[model samples]
Target: MWSPWRIVGESLLSVAFGLLGAGLAALDHGGTVRIAAAGLAIAALSLLRRTLPASVLLVTAVGSVLFGGLAPLVLVAAWSAGRRIDGVGRAVGTFALAYVLNLGMAVVQALPHLSLPRLVFGVLWPLVAIIVPGLAGRYRSQHHTLTDTLREYEAQQQRERAMIAGQARARERQRIAQDMHDSLGHQLVLISVHAGALEVDRELTGRQREAVGVLREASVAAMHELREVVQVMRDSTEAPHEDRTTPGVAAAAAAAAEDTTALSRGVAGIEGLVGTSRSVGAAVKLRHSGEPCPLPPTADHAAYRIVQEGLTNAHKHAPGAPITVELRYEPDSLVVEVANGPATRTTDNGRGVVSGGQGLTGLGERTRLIGGLAHAGPTADGGFRLAGVLPYTSPEGGIPSPEPGNVTTTFVDPTNTFWQQTPGDSLDEGAPVMNGNGLKELAKAMSRKNGSGIAIGCGMAVLISLLLVIAALGVGGYFLLNKAEEARIEPKQYDTVKVGQPEAEIRKQLPKENSFVTDGLETDAPPVPKGAKCLSLTSTESSNNPDMEPVFRFCFKDGKLTEKKSFEVRN
Candidate 1:
């Protein structure tokens, strides 16, 4: 819908264009009524721009046939229709109609003298008038639509972030309640136990016994209330399956299951795993050194995961190779090492079995969380080795606890940045390394999306080339003009010479060969008559628009000039 102000603005624009068109028509000897009629028609049609833009454009296009001044108003209405209309089909239809009408009118008006070439040239104005405004309007519409979409997307993202933050706060509150129940509920239970023991004392007065009974009753009541509190906290923290009401629960459950399975199947079953591998036609051996120490749960988990991952690598990469698993317990550290010999033959159905290559990466992440280091690489021999070192006890003589506030995590996609060897890197390298190929690919993708950047670069190159050419031409022109001005000329001698003058006489009257002749033109003139010779002389002009030097020709017949004329070099 067009506002009143907008309608007025459109009217003003239409009238202004009408006046301009009338002025142009007046230049072509149009009458005052014709000019006034065109102006009034444009102003009237523009009033229907908002509600009936297509209809307005049609009428204005037709009107332009009678008053050629109304063409601008026709274009304006076409543009408005294209911008305001809902469907591209309708706008395109309107554009086509206007084009046909305008062309038909032109053809009708000039039917007496229309030719293929003239018709083509006449068709160009209407074509451009229809298409350019339509395209511009289409671009404006698309731009606005895109801007609206981006704004909506940004608003949606903000809402999503607020929702996620609220969810995190709720989860945190639940976690706090659960922790209180876990840590404080036991202390309350101990108080209830002690009060019960006092209540049952063998030696006591009636009042003392009564007091003890009261104390025990109160303690029991408190313990019951505490249990209720603990139960409520547990219920809140662990919502029932039907009441979970959250996304990612299934993924969380699956990840927990995987972790539990890996822990159970990793370090605890090392010997069994080795025996199982041997049973499956793999030559494997396990060895232990140093006294076995009671390792922390985290250390044991890390150690087990390292050996499990190493054996898995052997199975996948070095199939049929003899593998050795070594567990060494130092005074402070426990090390797990797995090595394999060169692959003897294909132990699986397929050759070069493709792997997602994340087994070692996950293992590394797990070990690092518990203050351990993991390494894997090719061995000096045609084989592979995997090694890990986990500290059984931290320097503080206790298991290391994860510090939540001070931890920063950077996730590396294994598919993109595959592990690569670094300078002096050993088989125990655990730090993530980015692949060079991935970075180059990312850069190329970014460049491809930047169309304006590429266009600007090409434009700059062309501009620089143009400037250089202009500078070179300027310097060369300056030197040529300076040399031409400095050269001397014998004007009187050449002016007095006759048309049949002798070649020797003309040569003597000419300036020094090194002076004026340098800028003069030299060319072979037309052949002289029988037994005659031809001569040419070149000289610069004395004018503001001096260009090429002029050449003077002379025909010498029997040692005398016959004909002479001057010609300027064209280019």
Candidate 2:
């Protein structure tokens, strides 16, 4: 999966690391074999850092302990391991193992000349080379992951929003189709019934009777076509059977006919609906209560459909039953109810009045669209009731209101012994609550997956690194200042040293040996006396010229100071 440019870049980086490690080994006075080994190890580490970073890190850490020239490679390897590792546990474990190896080697190397400063440096050296670089790389990796996760989450949200909008549009179109089927189909059936009654009148001419028969046929045809269009508009699950007869058309046509009025779009139309049913020999009554309040056009239309559907169902299913239509206008809403008693006659009148079964469903949808609720079920006294609550003011943007009204009446079906509930009320109770809980659980899951522990670990690593840096600087500065003071001896102190003095006494009078200035002084200094040991020290007094410095030397033999010499050495 590596790109050509990335491969080229890695090759160049490997070569650079190899050359750099080799040069450092040469500068440290390593032999040819050691230099080559260091170069190859660094080159291998750079090449495999991405694919096998942990293995490369372990190898480099061991090399650093064995060869001082390869110490710098350990940091690079640790950084790579941190960045490439998948989880906190793996990255932390790998870095800890490397640190342990380096620390163990440092401890063994320093055991011969171990002091407080050397011990502290030994521990802190590995920490700086490993812990700090590892933490920084881990932080970088986590930041990149978090950023990518946020981008993907945003894109997913956008896609979900678009999908939801599309669903809303589809449901709206289905509602419109249902409205047409319920409202227009009812009016068309009434037209066919009235035309059928007129065609049988003996007072009309033969030609006029033919025209009325044609009109009735046309209305029936229109209803059939309307059903086809509504079925096409609906989803497959709700599509009605086209072959079933339209309810109330043939039965109402067979009953007595009466003068008809243009139906109102609101509560005022209930009287006309009842009158039509009465003409068809059904016992129906209309009752009104409270002062009528103005209603929005959508709510008004919904109220009318509820009554029409109720009357139609009653005429078709409960023949010879008495029906009542009630309209109560409350302070904020209009309540419409249609209740019918038990049937007195069976539906075997040879005029099939089978229900299409979508009337009440479409009525419910219409009521909900305009901030209303619909309910229909059998009553306690062997009867059925269809009821609805409509708000006086339509909701904004045609969206249903969460709470429709304060009216809380429950009707129980005698046969089923269950309460009839509105679709809006049931969905509000269950789906929203469940969806809210699901969203909360999803958020918690994401938080757990993203690893807050890694952030905490990185912070702890940074704090420890700072403390180690401060401790190392403090210890190093103390040793440096102490050594500078111990390495200098004054002119008076040097003069006080006597030749032939006991070595113990001479040592007490002289300052501590200055290893910094005297590390290889024997090779450049004048010849020493036979069977003698020498101690070298630098003078506190500076030479007048910058090119030279003064040094003091003492030789001991036979438990006495055998020789004392002072010289000016070139810088």
Candidate 3:
């Protein structure tokens, strides 16, 4: 069904074509009744060009032949037929029928004086009027189809790229959760074990034993909560790994052991961390400067991890060195620094502790999540230092504060995961199982093979059809001009004709009849001699004067010229 706007537009187009047909009818020297009737019929039938293109085309083609004023409507109908018809075979057959009708009518009209040139001109003129516009319509239809196909293909590619990016982010979130679970859970377990040992000491007072028992219970509760949080963070489709021997799991466990050696910790737990180190006979000291201020939980956790990493590195690399942990509360930020002097004892004291160097990498990643900076390197002295600067409020307005009575242990991963996926991993169900190279090749193939072939083929056909039309017009125009020149006679030649000369001799001297110029000669010319046939020809010398046209009439009776007269007809 057509929309109202579309119907209105097409109706307006039909009205304009009707007006054009009427004007062309006015140009013809036919009776007013015939001209008006042809114009009205052309206008009425144009309305059905889109809906009944084949029928309208046949009617208009016949009308153009009979009335000669509906040629434009015939061309319009031909174009509509090409566009609305479904298949190539049907369109070609319809156009062929219209063309044959036009050519056959022209042949019948010219049968009395038909020549080879007239027949050729008739055939070529109808080809130009009908075939050219029809081919143009088909080319335009093909162009629109190709454009729509390309648009749909581009939309599909965009959807695929977005889906791939989403899967990569889900994988990265799982990776972060795994790292946090392995690192935080191991430290909590160690704290529980140490506190349980302390609670059994006979030398401790009752109050001290109660404190140790509470610490042990707290560590156990924290570990359980951490496990539950990690499970929630992992991808729901993934199953827990029962085998701990996988390389990824083993690597994670090793990195976690080097994270913290003593207790479950955070910004508030730093003092207990230092005290535990001191109790183990390590010279660890804590220092503070500037005013203390509150910090967001994510930043506070990052600061504690920085100090814990420093102490852990010191134990592994500088066993007997004096270590210092400093906490400075700047006006807008919390600065943490941990430094240890050179080692005074061998690191290989029968405790084979292997460092995989992932602790500082994980610490840096964790600090950056809260919009902080972490650094670790050798100091000026023969020592090493680890430091981090955490804003009191994160630059990104801090992570949302945890709900009351709920712990906010989950950290936001700040890195872009779209570019982090391994190329060979499956994206998800029902997606194409291909790598990055395969995707790139597929895109290139679509671009290379989309629509170039169709465009070129249509363009060539249109070009060839236009060339044929131009050539036909050129040949037809040349012949018509030659015929017009041959049909013109000079004033001197007209005056030389004798009334008593033989009709054949006078014709040999005079030029052929120029019906194009002599058809409208004045009817008031002197009456021809009784029972004599007359021939009229235009004068070439008199054509220069626009106010009058000169025509010579010669009459023949009994096989000889009887009268010759020259008339100056009004223009």
Candidate 4:
């Protein structure tokens, strides 16, 4: 309401009015104090009109009545007060006061010379000044309120649109996570099982057994980490760290991070990653510097994911390129960099790698979650580089000490019944144990489980159908009753009847017996005059008590109709 632009504009307008008034007054009586006083009053009114509208209006009106050159400032203050005041009561009161002051001043100043016309003009001018501008100001205020309401409504719709988009994205991610858990998790578990069996074989040599052990450990860890990744993807909380200071949030986050790190501890897989790349027939090198220090689980997971995503990009986008993996453990942070030289040979399959750029976007989001920085771009030597730096401290703040009763551990004994090594439970003995009858029984059980759901769905459908049918029948019955009531006719045909027409023809012109007319007309006549042949034309019949009465009497003498008359027939 009192923005800088508004203040500046009002001030300029006020000054202009003040200067014009002072110039006109100087032509009549050249007074310096009058000019200065008028200008000061106008400027103050303009500046404080929005903040202290009532006070400004009252002051400016009084000053205008007392001084010669400040009357226009009253107009400006009155207009502004009209807009600022909530209702017309205050505005009307202030305007009335100003009108009285102006009128009294005019009468006092020119009483000896004032005529009736002049007096009326002086009184009306003050009313015009107050009413016209005040109405305009009220209109402007209403328009402004309407504009603000529309803007707020548009902003609310925009927020709802953004929320819907976010919800759709969340649902899609949940679906992908569920698919990964159902499909990939089962495969990894099978691999872990087979590796465990191979690691325990007695015929294998020591070196062969060592390789199997690494494979088994890697398989088990991979499975454990996969579950953690799925859980994180399915989680609805966008900012996991914002709740770290809450009672159990830190512990939950720490547990999730530890589960993610089950495959390898911090900085444990740099050499193995390079070895795998070299084994794939790519020129790869690993470099390390500084002393490795322990990192919080969140940071550790971030560092591992960064290197893993970098190597994956290299393998997919630049196959057979020489890649360099660098690790630097600074006093405050751990920096990891993976850079790949230009590809010496690219396979057809490598060119077909589908990259929608979500990988890098996801990597960036993950790094930021742990208070780390990640960068990926093309190198100057026609190569690509991916790099990241992770702080050892917790992402929320400094590392939080586990509080009492807030620690949660999922480290169950490996020899528990869930993972026990029962004898004769090898893959050969445990595989494909279900026979035909067992399969049939399993199918029956599944059908039984689904039957209740199907029955409930059908019952709901039937209920809805019955309700719709009942509504349709009620609507049909209403229309039918209305149609039957509308069948009753008025005696428009009676107007066509003539005095000398045949009695049989007049009887044919009348409505049938069961039909009724609105006019209380009788179909049967009183006993015809003497022995003259009589014919009665019916008009209406009572449905409730048909024998009660007929009021209309259409009479015919001899064979031809002679006259038509009616008499009231009461029960």
Could you tell me the TM-score of candidate 3?
0.57
Over the stretch 278-334, how does candidate 3's per-residue lDDT look in tens digits?
Answer: 765579989999999988766776777787778767765776689999999999899
**Model 2 poorest ten-residue lDDT run:** 250-259
Top candidate when judged by TM-score against the true structure: 2
* Stretches of model 2 off by over 4 angstroms after superposition: 236-269, 275-283, 287-306, 313-357, 360-464, 467-471, 488-501, 513-557, 562-571
RMSD of each: 22.1, 11.1, 15.7, 31.9
Worst 10 residues of 4 by lDDT: 417-426
User: For model 3, where is the 10-residue window of minimal lDDT?
Assistant: 243-252
2 against 4, candidate with superior lDDT: 2
* Residue 3, model 2, lDDT: 96
TM for every model, in the order presented, reads 0.42, 0.66, 0.57, 0.33
Candidate 1 residue lDDT tens string, 1-571: 7789977887787678767876867865679997776566666677667678788877777767766677777677777777887786877788888888888888897676454434654566665566566665666665566556555644544444333333333334443343343224333333433444454567777788788667656655664565566556545545334323222211111112222433454456688767756755678899999998877655676676676666666765666699999999888888899999998765223423333333565456445545677898898888999998888774333223323332111132223211122222211113222223333443355445543354465456446545655655566556555544544343444467797667788767653333223322433234445665555555544423465455555566766777776555532
How many steric overlaps does candidate 1 have?
A: 5
Please list the residue runs of candidate 1 whose C-alpha ends up more than 4 Å from where it truly belongs after superposition: 1-8, 21-35, 203-571
Error (Å) of candidate 4 at residue 397 is: 45
Clashing pairs in 4: 521-552, 522-551, 522-552, 523-538
